[model samples]
Target chain A: MIQDRLRTRMGWLHAWSGFVFGLLLVCIFASGTIAVFDTELTRWLQPEVPPSATALTDEALEETLPTIRKLLERDEKPFITLPSERDPILRVQYHDGHEFLNIPFDPGTGQELAARATVGGTFFYDLHYSLRNGDTGIIFVTFSGLMLLIVLGSGIIIHLKELIPDLLVLRPFSARLRAWLDVHVLASVPFLPFAFMMAYTGTFLHTRSILPPVSYLASINAAITPVAVRAESPALQKEKTVVPALPPLSPLLHDAEKVVRAGQVGFILFLPKNILISRTDASGPARTREHVDFSYDGHFIRHVLLTTPLTRTQQVMEGIHYVRWGGAGMRWLYFISGLATTIMIGSGLVLFLMKRRRLSGGRVIFRLAEGLTVSVLVGFPLACSGFFWGNRLLSGGSEQRTQEEVTVFFLIWAASAVWGMGGCLMKWRVQVWRSELGLLAVLSALLGPLDLLTRSGGTVFHTPTVFAAVDLIALCVAAVAFQIARRLA
Target chain B: MIVLCSVLWIVSLSVQAVSEPRMLRIARREAVAPALTVRLMRWVSLVGLLLCLYQRPSTALFVWLGSFSIATVVVALGWAWRYRGVQRVRRTGGGS
Candidate 1:
């Protein structure tokens, strides 16, 4: 009787909590899943740049620094991130608001590429962890992650008796609700380890912002800032002096890679007097979370490793969460696992409403929940497709072209929300779901064609298979949306 | 390699089915006595999967175990569907 009572209480918590926060979790999971390919998506977003052959050599690095130096403002923090497998172009970038205003350069030469200024894959990355609302978003996501952990625990308790059976048995032709539940179990069982890993690691990544003890009390206020904000370092700032010219980065890069045992020098952060080059990309799974430091004039400094057990554990957690060391195959595995998690959340949303709809079909609160469901499930994808279309169609010469692209995305998404809610109010729930999904299908189908038509000089010269692959993925999205729409109809 | 992994997965599930009568409606009485050996073979297949991937053991274990679970689920469902279909055909006395 006690066990039964515990299971019943857990089932209630699992269902009610999921219903309350399912939409937000779905968006977070979906965006995060997509972010596994953020590098590729960023490449796809800007199709005009020619493919880069290799990273900058010593002479090329020396030539590029002058232009990069000219672009730096007195207060601005300038960074040079070397190219990785997914993103071939070297970037001289800095944090703006939600996006990076980066100057892309030919890695082989010092020549700059005229890539259009737009938010690329970084948009999904921002949306995933923080929802681009800065600290509040991070806190909210962290809290939701906690909620997910609770839900996972409760769900497992409720299903513990049948966990193994659930893993092995999937009854597709069973009663409708049973079928959905079986699927939920199937998707959840094999991927439970991944889900728990992501939840804990994701929360840990933003622990400084969320936990009061690790950070100063004022950090709570600082979290409200719209940009990339961090707690001020306790170390005193160096005296203001004339900035010195940088030495050739090639030698530093070679030495840093050797010291850190990382394949590629992912990025170099230039401090007032020191340079910190982080090992962002590594060749294989044994990648270390080590960084190498150097004096301003290129003299080698000591290697910095996460030696403390706590910090090292955190580093390992982050490594598994981000998969920075993994090659393409590993990235694809992350992507697929992420997609499965997304689907799992999505089906849970469906089950939540399906159960509620049967009992209180026309109740005001139920209708509102149904409307929100339609908006989130379909509206976000519609907004993403609009962003891609706007990137291609919006004129490049406008002063606020980047902002305009973002504005277009939000406007379309807001419009879809309003339409979904209005349709629900007017008793057009089915119609709303069908139409929004259909529109998404059409928009997704057009992204590839739009890219093909708008290819400029560099895109025409060097054939980028990445662009083709991206377009193919968009077509696949369209096909999936169409299939869903047909099923709903 | 993907094919080899799939075959190993099938063997793992088949071993489970042979060892445990509850897993399937049709199991030979003699099959139940090989339970210990069959269980041991399942572990061997799992270890083989980890070796075949040739990656960090943690990552390979995560990737291949998840893959094996999915493949097992697929084969189990297929068996269920076939058994149901055969039952239906016998009941109707024809393939109509």
Candidate 2:
């Protein structure tokens, strides 16, 4: 009797929790899945930037830093980022007034290249983490993660008996409820560990925001201010009295290489007397903070470890969330887990409508559920595809690219919502589902070729690993749309 | 035997909640006692769990002991409440 009661409680918890967060969870899952290959996506988005044929050498880095330093000193505080295998251009970021400037420098000569309107890869990085909405996005995503934990826990309780029996079950003929239940259980059970890890890490990522104010108070008292120090301003130094003789960069590059033992030196920045060299370790986890610093004129300084033990712990937590450290096998595992999460959210939403249909026994509730399902499942994907379309269609160097992308996203999402509502009036389930999926498939498939034509083949065929992966994903989505269309037809 | 029966009841209740519509119907039928008591019990349990998590117990031994003790008490209370409600409902319905 007690066991039965406990199970009942778990069922209630899971069903309601999953229903409430279903839409947000779907958004998180879809966005996060795409974000897994954020770097590749950026490369695909911007194919005009040619990949460097020659590796950036220490001598080249040394020669380039002095000029970069002089330019950076003239403007705002300049922090130079050395290029890696992933990105070929040396990037110098500085602030002029409220506006930020990201100037790419030729790695071989240290000469300033054309200033880009967008910091291409970093834009994707920012978008994935915070959606460029800052703290609001973090709070929203973290809350979604917490709700996911509740859903996972409750789902297990509700399906304990069928868990083992229905491990591989995917019944296509069953009623909507049964189908949804099968999908939810099937997707959730196989990737329970990965889901749990993501939830825990996601919660940890937003610990400061979710926890009581006392934690922040304790942080301040513990001598840990969250504010980071600004890099020395290039503009201030530029205005300062000229010192004709500047330090040579070769010695500094050599010293940094010795300290970091990186296979290649990507970029070097000299700020008056300080020389910063960035090294790349492709095999290990991505660490933007680990680099070698030196005094201008090649005097060995200390290796600047940007991340502390505490921060490293956070990085590892985020690494699990981002899945960057893992090899091809782990990447595939994460990909499957992410797909499962998407299915779980989608199924949970369907389950909500099924339960409502059973309760209401009226056409009104069914219509509402149908509209909601259309808006959430189909609408969100359409919005994302619009963003990619905008990237392709908008001319390069156009100041309105960001604005246009945002506009396309909002317009598509709004149209989906409106169409969903209208479909309810006509009771046209087949029409709604077919049209939405059809449009999505068309848009997604068009993206690859459009990218090829517009952006000089947009990395679709650049490297086999990336090209095959992206093309395969796009094809699978297209297949799903076709299947849905056939069913509707 | 009582504990085993209680466990079985909870398990059955959970499965019924998912698979059968009758359990929710029954829950709705019980106007006050079962519905209200279950909700109150849940809130109390949730609060206790939150407190335990927030404190961050220093030792593994301490955590194990505290968790076991809390679980025992919460389960006992929940089971007792449920048994009482069932008995009252049965008496009122005259063994329907």
Candidate 3:
């Protein structure tokens, strides 16, 4: 009787909490999944930048100094990141007051490619962790992550007896409610380890941001300034006075890689009197604080690697979450797991409404919940595909072109929310899902053709694999969406 | 090695499914004790993990866990396909 009471209460908590936050969690997980290939997505977003496989040449590394020096002169914190497997082009990026502006360089020649500016892959990264709202978003997402643990715990407790017994059973052919519950279980139970790992690692990462120690007192200046300006770092300013000609980075990279591991030097941060060459995330599964420092003019300084137990544990956690060392296969694994996880949460949302549709189907609040469901499930995906569309169609000359691409994403999502809610207002829930899904299918199908039409011949010549792979994935998504849309009809 | 690990995981899960009485009944096969089969299945998976660890010690743990989830999903989908086929066979008055 006690266990029964516990299960009953836990069921209510699981159902309500899962539905409430699932609306946001689904989007977060979807975006996080996409972010697994953020580098590839960023490449596809800008068609002008050509991909290369060649290693960085010494001359090319030296050529970037002129640009770096110019940025340094203008009081900017410019840094150089080496080419990685997924992103073949070298990058010179700096904070441009609003965000980091990345300039792609040919690894062989250090010639800057005229890539179009957009948020690119980090858009999804930002969406995944922070919901694009900065610090406030981080705090909110952290709380939601804690709630996710609660929901998962309650759900497991409620279904403890059935978890292992029904582990391999997924009856898609069963009755409607049963099928959805089967899907929810199949998606959740098998991937419970991943769900827990992601939740804990992700939340732990942002724990530092939410902690009170950093801001023992609130910043009054934050309220006074309507527009936040980039503050010049005092260290960088002091370094600017010295302005000594630095040695070629290729040799330093060679030496750094010896300690950091070959082909693992991720980025080079320049200071007035020192240069810090940090190990790239792809170096290993542990994101260690390992770097090799040098004095002005290429004199070798000491190498740094943290070995404390607590720090090692943290580094491993960071590594697990980031998966910077992941290859194509691992990336796809992460992607599928993330999508499956999202589906678990999404199906729970569906089950919540399905369980209640008979009693509250016509209520205003119920209709609103149904609409929000469509917005999150159907609309968010449409907006994702729409982001690619906007990247291609929007003219490149406008200053607000980047913002316009972002606007396109938001506008489509908002419109989807409106369409879903408005249709549900008229009791057209089925019609709304079917129509919007069909639209998503059509748009996603068009992405490939649009890529063929819009992308430069140079980009195609440079990276045929990237162009084809991206288009093929879009086509696959379209095929799935079309089938689901057909089923709903 | 990771590929080998993934294949082993799927095979283990498939073994787990076939050893289940419900699955055997659906397939029209007689049930047997799964104790030995379960032990062998687990050993296969463990050796696969050992091979992965031997190959890439740092990534093996996460990769092992990652492959486990993915492989379980694959087995579940396979079971669904098998179950659906059996159901269709029954509806059409065919033998399981």
Among these predicted structures, which one has the highest lDDT? Answer: 3
- lDDT by residue (A1-489, candidate 2, tens digit) is 987998988878877777767876787777676766665655455555454535555555555546555665574356655665455666666543222346556667665554324333344345445555555566667777888888888778777887654544443434446656766765677567667877888788877655636665664433233222212445334345343355665566566767767555544544555666765534345444466776644556777665678888876676556655444444554565677778778877877776776666357757876787788788988887777677667666877565665677778988997898678657776788889999988987776676567644345447444544665677678777767777653
Tens-digit lDDT string for candidate 1 (B1-96):
444565777787767655655455322134347747667876656655666567455567556755665566566677557566544553466643
Worst lDDT 10-window in candidate 2 chain A: A222-231
Ranking by DockQ: 3, 1, 2
List chain B TM-scores, each candidate.
0.58, 0.32, 0.72
| Residue lDDT tens for model 1, A110-145 | 678787887778788888888888778888898888
TM-score of 2: 0.68
Highest DockQ: give the candidate number: 3
What TM-score fits each model?
Answer: 0.86, 0.68, 0.89
After superposition, candidate 1 runs with Cα above 4 Å error: A171-175, A214-219, A225-242, A283-289, A456-465, B1-7, B10-44, B52-55, B69-96
Across residues A1-489, which tens digit of lDDT does each residue of candidate 3 receive?
999999999999999999999998998889899888887888889888865557778877888888888776776778898888788888887765444567788888878877788778878888888787766677778778888989999999999988886777777765678878988998999889889989888888877655645452453233233333423545334333536676888888888878877877888987666889998888777899589999868889999989999889899888888787867767777887898899999999999999999999989999999999999999999999999999998988888887898899999999999999999988999899999999999999998889978876734345477778888888988998898777763
Model 2 spans > 4 angstroms off: A58-128, A212-251, A264-288, A291-301, A304-312, A361-372, A425-430, A457-468, B1-96
Give the per-residue lDDT digits (tens) of candidate 3, residues B4-95.
Answer: 77789998889888887666765567887777757587557898788878887766776787788888888888888877876557656775
Residue pairs that clash (backbone atoms under 3 angstroms), model 3: A266-A280
Docking class of 3: medium
Q: Per-model C-alpha lDDT, please?
A: 0.74, 0.60, 0.82
Better of 1 and 2 by DockQ: 1
Q: Tell me the TM-score for chain B of model 2.
A: 0.32
What DockQ results do all the predictions give, each relative to the true complex? 0.26, 0.02, 0.52
